[model samples]
Target chain A: METLFDQELVVINMGLEDFAKTLKERGTRVMHVRWQPPAQGDADLLSLLDKLK
Target chain B: MSKIDQANKEAVDKMMKSRPVWVDIGRAKDVIPGMKDNLFLHAGPPITWDRMSGPLKGAIIGGLIYEGKAKDEREAEELAASGEIEFAPCHHHNAVGPMAGVTTPSQMVFIIEDKEWGGNTFSNMNEGYGKVLRYGAYDDEVLNRLMWLDEVYASVLKEAVKLSGGMDMKSIIAQALHMGDDAHNRNRATTSLFIRTIAPFVVETEWGKKTDYDAPRLDLTNVSEYFGKNKATAAAEVLAFMHSNDLTSLNAIMAACKSMALAAHGVENSTVVTTMARNGTDFGIRVSSTGDKWFTAPANVPDGLYFSGFKSSDANRDIGDSVITETVGVGGFAMAAAPAIVNFIGGSPADAFDATNEMYEITVTENNNFNIPAMDFKGTPTGIDVRKVVEKNIVPRINTGIAHKDPGVGQVGAGIVKPPMEMFIDALKELAK
Candidate 1:
C-alpha cells in the first residue's frame, strides 16, 4: 500500500476529453479514450442493434 | 462469420487490390460511356436546376456558353432553365469531378483503367484554381482557357500518355502517401511526381511524324524537323503549365480513386461504402450491397481557415466529388501522412494525428498500401462500414475546398467537413432490412 502511494499514478480516462487534459496538466500520465455512447444513445437504433446480435 | 462480415471482406479485398492506370485521354463525349452532346454530368446524386447550388448552377451556365449553345450569361441562364439541357451525376457514367464537378461533353477527360478488374473510369481535366469553371467562374478568360485545354493541351497530353504506355496511378498514390500527400487536399507531392514521370515522354512526342505510304521517302534526318519545332514549343508550354499549378494531378487522382471504389461495388450483403460525394446542395453515398441506390442527406457547411478577404459565413455548403478520396481511405482519413496540409486546411500537426486516430474507431480495417509514417508506419483506416458508422454515431471526415455561396465568386477557403449522419443511418436501416 505504501509503495503504491509512493509510485506515480497512471490513468485511462474515457468519454470526456477535458478530464484527461486536466489530469495531464497536473503532471499525471493519462491516456484519453475517444468515446461516444453507442448509437449516440438513440433508443430505436439500440433496439435495431439488438437484431444484429 | 456473419454473412455481412464475409461479404464486406470480399469488397474490401477488391478495393485494396485495384490497380488504376491512366490509359488514355479524350473528350467526354467521345470516351465516357452514355455521354452525349446535350447531356451534362455534375457530381453527387441526381439533382434538378431548382435544387442545385449557386456553384453548380453557375458551372452549367458556363458549360452552355462554352458549348456555343448560348452566346452570353443571360442566354446561358435562360437555356439552362428552359429544360432543353439534360443533367445527370458523373457517377452514373463511372466518372468523378472536383469542386462544382460540372463536366460538359466538350471537355477533355482522363481515362483511367483498372488493370486488375478491367473497369475504366473517367474525370475531367483540372482547370488550376481560383476563378476556374469547376468553382463557377465562367468569364471570357475561363472559356478561353477551357478551349485551349480542350484542344491544344489535350492533344499534347494524349500523345505523351500514349508514348509512355500508361501511367501507374496506384503506385504513384502509394509513393505519394509516404512523401507527405493525402492524395486529395494535399497533392503537391503527387503533382511533382506526375510531372517527373511524364516530362520525358512529353518531349519525345510524335508531334510531326507524317506518313504517306505511296509517296517517296522524304529526307527526315533532322530530329527537330522530324518532331516539329511546333511540338517542342507546345511541349515546353505543357510542362510549364503543369508545373505552374500544384493541383495538376488532382483530377487524375480522383479518377484513380473512383476506379478503386467502383471495383468494390456490387458485392452481395456487404456493408462497405463504395461512394461518397456532394454536389454542393446534397451529400450522397452508395453501399456495395445496395448497388446503385444512393442514401442522401443535406450537406453540412465546412469549418476552417478562410482566405484574406473571406470568413466562414462567406463559404457555401460542402461541395465536390473529392470526398471519394475519403471513401477509399486516404484524404481526411490519412491526415497523419500530411501534417503540412494543416497550413492550407487549418489545424495543428497534433490535431491531424488525432483526426486519423479517431477514424479507426469506425472503420473496418487499415489499408495495406497507404501507410502513414507518423503512426509508426501503420496503414490508414480503410473501408467505412455503414453499421460501424451508425453504431458508433461517427461520420467520416472530409477535407475540401470551399467555394463562395454566390455564383462566380470562386473558392473562398479550404477546410474540414463531415457529411450529415442521417445518410449513414438510413443506409444502415436499409441494410438491416
Candidate 2:
C-alpha cells in the first residue's frame, strides 16, 4: 500500500495557482517549474530552483 | 462452517429471500393499507414529517393533488393534516421511486421479481425532472404526464419485460460495476445495457410504433441518453438485480465496513472513527471496533454544486440507497476516477484526489476494478476497517445526492458530506455490551 503512493504523481500547468494552493494544503509535496524556451534544460532547472527559494 | 459463520449465512439468506408484494394502484385503497397520514414516500429508508425538509414537504403536497385528495396546495395541506391519506416508504414496500419518491395509489408501478430467489421489488415510472411530480410540483401537466405513463408506458413496459423472458439484472450490474458505475449516481453504463437488452422487445410493442402517441421512446442514443430516456426502466432492473442474489454482497459490504470500523469504534484512547448511515430522519455513524450500535446525530448540509436555478437552501439533508457504497468503499471514497463528478458535487480535481487518498487511511481493501488512473491506477479503497479508522481518527467520506428535507424539493444537488459520529458511538456501546 505504501508503494502505491510512490508511483502516484501529478502534473499541473504553471498557471494554476489555486490548484497549487490546494495541493499544498493537502500536504502534497510540490516542485516548481521555470518558464523557458525549449532547449534550456539545465538553465531552466536551475532557475526553477532559484525561484522556489 | 463455524456457528458464527452459520448464523451470518442464515441472516444473509433471509435477506436474499425477502420479497416485495406487487400492486398496481387504480385507487388509493389498493396500496395504503397500513400507512399513516402525514407520511410521504421516499426511496431506501423510512423518514417522518418533522425530519423532512422543505422540498420533501412540497412533494407530499404535490402527491395529495395528484391523487385528487386535494384541489390546491392549501387544500392539500389540510387534507394531509386531516389524515385522509397514507404515507409509507417505498423501500418498506420493496419499492423505489425517483427523486422525491412520491407514489400515489394511481401511479403505475413495475413489480419486478428476482426469479433466482423469488425476491421481488417495485419502482414507479420515472418523471423527468424539471417541475415534475416527484419534485413536488403538481399541476395539470404533471397529472397529465402521470396519466400517460400509467395508461401507456407502464403497459408497454409490462409486456416488453414479459416478452424479453424477464431481464437478467444480475449480469447487467456485474458488467456495470466494471464500467465505471457504482450503480447509484452513475447509472449510464447500467442504463445503456438495460436499453440494449430490452430494446428488441420494446420495439415490438404497440406503443413503440405509434407516431401520434408521442410518448418518450427508449432508444440507443448513447449511454448518457439512456438515463434521460427510460430511467424508471433502468431503476427497476437494478432493483431487481440487487434483490436477486442473497450474496449480492451489498449488505456484506456494509457489515464488512462496520466490522473494520469496529477496530476504532470506541477506544477511549482513540480518535479514529468508522460507520455512517442515514435512517431518512437523522444520519448516524459508528467508530472502528466499537460494535454494531449507531451513534446518531442530525445530518448536516452537503457542500456541492446544484442544478441550474437551484440553490443550497432548496436541498434536503443527504439521503439515499447509495450509502452502502460508502460502507463498501466507493462513492466519495473513489472520487478521483470520476473527475466529471466535481461539476455536480462542488470540488476541484485535487479535492477529488484528496478525498480518495484520505479514504485509504481508514479502509481495508482496494477495489481492483474501480481503479483511478490519475492515482497511478491505484484501486479505490474498498472496505473501511474499524481498526484503521480508530488508529487514524478519520471518518469515511461520502458523496451523495441531497434530497430536499421537504418532500417536494426532489433533489437539490450532489455534494460531498460526512455521517454523524453519534451513530458510530452508539454502535460501539452496543458492541461493548
Encode model 1's per-residue lDDT on A1-53: one tens digit a residue. 77986888999999999999999999999998878899989988887766654
lDDT for each candidate structure: 0.87, 0.53
State iRMS for model 1: 1.6
lDDT of 2 by residue, B177-235 (tens): 55655444555565667667766776676554443444433332452354454543433
Best of the candidates, DockQ: 1
lDDT of 1 at B200: 88
Error of 2 at B171 (Å): 3.4
Question: How many clashes (backbone atoms < 3 Å, residues ≥3 apart in a chain or on different chains) does model 2 have?
Answer: 53
lDDT per residue (tens digit) for residues B1-433 in model 1: 8877888889988999999999899999999999998999998888998899989988998999999999988999888888888999999999999988999988999999999999799998888877888988898878877886777667778899998999999788888989999999999999999999998888887641322122222122242374554333556656767877889999999999999899899999888999999999999999999988999999999998899999988888888999999999999999999999999998899989988988897787889978898788998998998888888878998999999988899999999998999999898888878
For all predictions in the order shown, the interface RMSD in Å is 1.6, 24.0
Considering chain A alone, what is the TM-score of candidate 2?
A: 0.36
Worst 10 residues of 1 chain B by lDDT: B211-220
Which has the greatest lDDT?
A: 1
